[model samples]
Target: MADNLTKYREKRDLKKTAVPSGGASVKSSNGRRFAIQKHDSTRLHYDLRLELDGVFKSCAATKGPSLDPQDKRLAVEVEDQPLDYGDFEGTIPKELYGGGTVLLWDRGYWEPELNKSPEQALAKATSSSLLEGTGCTVFVLVRMRGNEDEKRTNCS
Candidate 1:
């Protein structure tokens, strides 16, 4: 767990930031929760964080995830965040790393389709995921064909 948060801690000072600085383990029953945060940073984008292992596997969507089946959004993988980070909604100082206003846009549980483990699917992912949130249910078709850092997905 400490190994996973190494990069996260290095990016920001725990004393100044309002975000969680990871150490203790967060208990979870299924560990299938996910959150989409709308961040107003250097640019406007949505942050998608999926709970995996003991942390949140993060990514930022430039145009945000679309509900239209034909719309594809560009998403880039980011550093892992603590589980509690999903509930954060505040303003980060302008001088800070992720300096901006963050709003918890959507949050709930998610389950990978085909009965496969999330870790197994994400590492070599080219599958569908069922994201059931409080506001809506999104059927996400995630594809990671090569070694590219960016991912384009059409969520319906």
Candidate 2:
């Protein structure tokens, strides 16, 4: 059932791009894949993607991560967006579709501070926990900090 949905999504008329050169710092050691997509929904939102156990887990936010520990933001759990959503960038026709822009945000594996496995981290994440109060969904990227001696990469 999920496979069929994935196939249908892939066939949608949306632009899709693989990880650009230097986009990924390193492949996931755990074999999980992930992507970050900027969605042009009614209001712009960042769609964080994490693939685990053959399923795509997703969350969304209108803003990026907050530095202040007190600032509570809630992230909404959205449907599993298509992988092609990663590269989708353009204006949706205002008449037929609401106009908006989409860009790649980030892509990597799912790593959590508490959980050692991707599944564990995913299982631990819930709409209430992720949403918290600020409304920002937290997603675990596979790459570890300081894993590479390279500078941070940002998605335009």
State each model's CA lDDT, in order. 0.79, 0.46
Q: Give the residue spans of candidate 1 off by over 4 A.
A: 24-27, 147-156
Per-residue CA lDDT of candidate 2, range 26-53, in tens? 3334445556567675887766666654
Clashing pairs in 1: none
Per-residue lDDT of model 1, residues 9-92, tens digit only: 999978887877876556665548889999999999999888888889888887876778788776777888988898889998
Span of 10 residues, lowest total lDDT, candidate 2: 125-134
lDDT over C-alpha atoms for residue 73 of model 1? 70
Residue 86 miss distance in model 1 (angstroms)? 1.1
TM-scores, all models, native as reference = 0.87, 0.51
Best by lDDT: 1
